[model samples]
Target: MPAQVLAPAPAVTPPRAGRGYWRRLLPALAVLACLTRVPSFTRPLWNPDEGYLAVQARILAHGGQLYETVVDRKPPLVPWLYEAAFAVTGSGSLTSVRVLAVLAQLLTAALLAALARRRWGDRAGRTAGVLYLLVSVGLNPEDAQAAGFEVFILPGTAAAMWCADRRRWTAAGVAVGCAVLAKQTGGAVLLPVLWLCVTSGAARTAAPRLAAGAALPVLGAALLTDPAGFLFWTVTGSTAYAAFSGSPLHALTRALGNAGLLAAACAGLLAAVARAPRAASADLWLWLAASAGAVLTGFHFFGHYYLQLLPPLALLATAALHTEPWARHRTAVLVSACACAVFLTWGLTAPRAELTHAQRVAEAAARRTGPRDPVLIWGMHPETYWLARRAPASRYLTAGLLTNYSGGRDGARVGERYAVDGAWPVFRREMTARAPALIVDDSRGKPYAPAHVPTLRRLLTDRYRVVGTVDGAVLYARVS
Candidate 1:
């Protein structure tokens, strides 16, 4: 018989308490995130939707209904969220909104850190949190200037990521509900939810969780803000205009644009997943869902739609870096540093709303005029008129469609095409009736609202004589 020597019991090192560390760490990270995200918040509120959403929030806080006052046909989640922020902050100023978006980004980063720790352990999560802070430029409420929809989608999707990974159907459903209520693009989670519904362990557990989770929106609607006009916006407001995502064939064009590198990356991920079936389920879900969102947004939606993918892509990128660092076992730190740098650069340089000197000059002109002044802004943010503490000149507003929102045929088409093709005829009519006294149209973002995205129709330029030029914006006065 081989003598088996009894091995001495291994000594276990006592775990250190994290209370002190967490106490010191959280506020520092939060301050860092706030500093980066709040600088140019005014940029996002400048977007049309932000103005709409902000108005709705103010209305909601005053216990007002949406359809009665605002063009709020969508779900009331965003307004209510804004209301809560407003209540706590006691201000309806856009500054409060920017603060909320920054806070949301911070919380989102914290949640991502939690998810990362569960998947990759403590170190990676902390690293991800720091990275999130450093690169959270667009995650702030100021993002409303660019597109608040993406920020709205992040929290719920991140929650969904957490719940799905834990195989908690109800939790995922709740997250999905909040997301959907926040923004329409959140419906993108349908694919992953379906995947969860089909799996075995998920079969029994997922349904009830889903039902419970669904109650959030219903509850929000009943107990909170009731946006009865939501359906109207979904059916009418959303499609009233043609999408500007690089045109109809944009999907094919963008796909082909990055065909070589994208294909290789997807192929690589697919193979790796196939080989590692036992890998962390949360990580896999994050990667696949994000990849799906990227492909869907890139191929299906307009370039602006890329805003939807920021959070997930952030997580996916973090996870990929974490995994690769382990495999390569060398230069992991260097690679992470480089990735952080890239993210920071992207955050800082992402396409955002900005007012040029010309815009400022037009603003000055608008200021020179009073609310009683016939301030015609055919091609600019009408709010500039309102904000300068002035009012607009006419009832016919230049927006997505040329439909008669008030009444009468107005001899203009209603579909989204009105801006792209219908604008010339409509502008001619508006010029005939009430040419704007002032105009401020961008060379980017909503500038293309009337002119279409990617390129503006120079033909529309013929209707207006340039009163002033600001940055990429051209302020127009009706050519007599």
Candidate 2:
């Protein structure tokens, strides 16, 4: 028989990567690029959402339980992050908090680039990183600016996705666990990450490892620190959040409108996924569904909620922009770029609610009150309390609890009680016992009203005197 010779096995070519120098420098450049927001980092806290977290962080730093001393309908992870920041650089320094925030954003951007590069190509990786930085920093409104919980969630989610793609199942689980700790919705990433492990034939081993890795931070924090606090805030307390925020349909409309370029790119991404190889497409589609579920879970789709979708969406968009024919890629890029440009322009130029006014208000309050003096803000400006480093007089930091207790129009609709009306007596008792040294009423241009809670009305009338006014804030000093 003629000697049978096997043809030389086809040589495999490693995918082309950035040139040596570019590879070394790109990630560094991405980090530096994200840090450009350093200028805005030291600005005073203005938005209530950030202020709420900041205040809770301050509380934690001062030996307060996550839910007992301060209350919110979210998880404890963000408060812990803020507490850590306070420990590192002294509590209530806008610069300290913002610096930590910048670092988080930078880390997230770098991880996003790594994920894009590994899944797509070097060019897509760089593009995705740059895109995320711009969209996150530039496109976010003032309310969602610098250290938002959503920003914090990004790095963890991106890390999870990146590790899962590389089959680092345990690390992926840990990363996602961190994300979930940051925000309750972070658990959403768990589905896709475990799915990847199972489909890749590592389910038996990877699943347990992933579960253990994920449970470490959460379980450790819960058991060692505050189990009841975590359970109430993250799960039970959050039940009423959706009812008061907005309907799912309304949230969907607002999310699409605010998401801007990202929404459009997602449409293109769907098309790209449809045309992709079956295995890869399956992963991408599952990821998208998982992200969408996370965003929609509370049925109050805040713009930041859509952020969790960015990594998968960015990957798919990059594929549509670069992996396809020139004509289609060009059209996709142009449409996305144009929409992104419009959103970016608006975000950059849209007049932001100035914190200077808020800072001035907080400074005035700080000057009037002593270190241990309890300060009360009647409205939603928790930032004032955080900036002044003054402890809140009552467990209910903002009036949302008080106003929503009786089924106010602003909350769970007319006649549908949002909070237990039974809590009103407790609210009255807490405020009366605390007897806040100074009350800063922020009605957001409306006259402060204590009508909602009769106890507040009595306290305002009998126990407090209007000491001064700082812009829209009416400062009341305890008199009786």
Candidate 3:
């Protein structure tokens, strides 16, 4: 340095984010997670899926067996999860299940953040978590906030990805298995995880461990539950469910509509990814593809089904954010911010309406029957059981099986088809074993109406008399 002009002081570098940074950031993420779910907190029912799970859980809590005593096409863990929630917070509390959904989201966010941080850095981690919190609810709040299979499977799915990224092959497998146990589509995570292992050069060691770990939960489930029932409902029945689709043109139209909806809701994230310098890694693309396949499995692109796409999208979007300057992505950022604002506002202002048609029927049914009485609902409203505080008279919660009316299709064509080959016998046997005290014919004019099915019409005529109607649902009382 010259005598009068010393070299400029070395430029001071900002300290790399440390434990203190995460210590503060984690709690902030938790707060954001809770805030986003505020809308689901007040509503007693957000979606029919919740009611289905709630009723199943209620039955399970009251000593009913999964698949055998309480039936649904879903895997066993979600019902068990509901049972656990009911156990802690008391049965028939939608708020409790909603609370658990919040916790699941929070946990998923934290896991994604940690996974991104481990792979990328602190900025990417923070962005990933924040993005998940905002975008996870960017769709219809009714589906997004429910304790549905998608919501419950997320934490496990995220954990599986995180573990696979870290080369924790066995843990990744177990997490994926747990996710599958929540929803059959969760097995889609396995492809990305296997790809991760292959790319990481641990395919041999990791593959066996992953397979073994995955089999643990599934085999345990088979042993713990009714093996035949579990297999039929989850595997065989789900396959049939997924296979049901309309004509090719109609299916394509539906698929396109679903894609458009997804694009609109995820515009910010999509834009951010477009602006990125490089495409996401192959494993991530595979993750996205697998999730898309899962969403399309039933050919019913429900808003909630799009939720499986979020973790991958968030990670990719945050990766883009990490590489690009924030100022350059102002439009995407603003779009995302606005999306979050709109979602939160809707949640806060959504009408806490009076009892739904199902609930009104539930109420009327409840008034007519004792606590121990079993009630039957004729349509797709299994939530009536939970609302009525009554046990279901049959294992078939909804009439889909009885009518061959695929839940994935429009109800107009329901009666055009006959009942599934073996469904009516099971229905008759279950009804005979434990006669329902009240039958709510929610599908009076719909295709699945009892009047359209001779057996159902005869049974209702012989054993039940129309007593009342609530909100268009005809209520029938058992004639002693």
Top TM-score prediction, candidate number: 3
Worst 10 residues of 2 by lDDT: 2-11
TM-score of each: 0.63, 0.82, 0.91
Write model 3 residue lDDT over 314-361, tens digit each, in one string. 887776777677674455566776788887787677654433676678
Model 3 bad stretches (over 4 Å): 1-18, 247-261, 276-280, 329-331, 351-355, 407-421
Clashing residue pairs, candidate 2?
none
Q: Report the error of model 2 at residue 357, Å.
A: 4.8
RMSD list, candidates in order:
9.3, 6.0, 6.9
* Per-residue alpha-carbon lDDT of candidate 1 for residues 229-328, written as tens digits (9 for 90 to 100): 4555544454533233334354565445444323222232323333432323444454456546644632343333444444444454455555664553
> Please, what is the whole-model Cα lDDT of each candidate in the order they appear?
0.50, 0.66, 0.78
lDDT of 1 at 99: 67
Model 1 spans with C-alpha error above 4 angstroms = 1-25, 38-52, 55-65, 72-75, 79-93, 131-147, 193-202, 222-228, 235-237, 240-304, 314-354, 357-365, 368-376, 380-386, 390-398, 401-480
Best by lDDT: 3
State the lDDT at 334 in candidate 3.
69
Error of 1 at 62 (Å): 7.6
Name the better of 1 and 2 by lDDT. 2
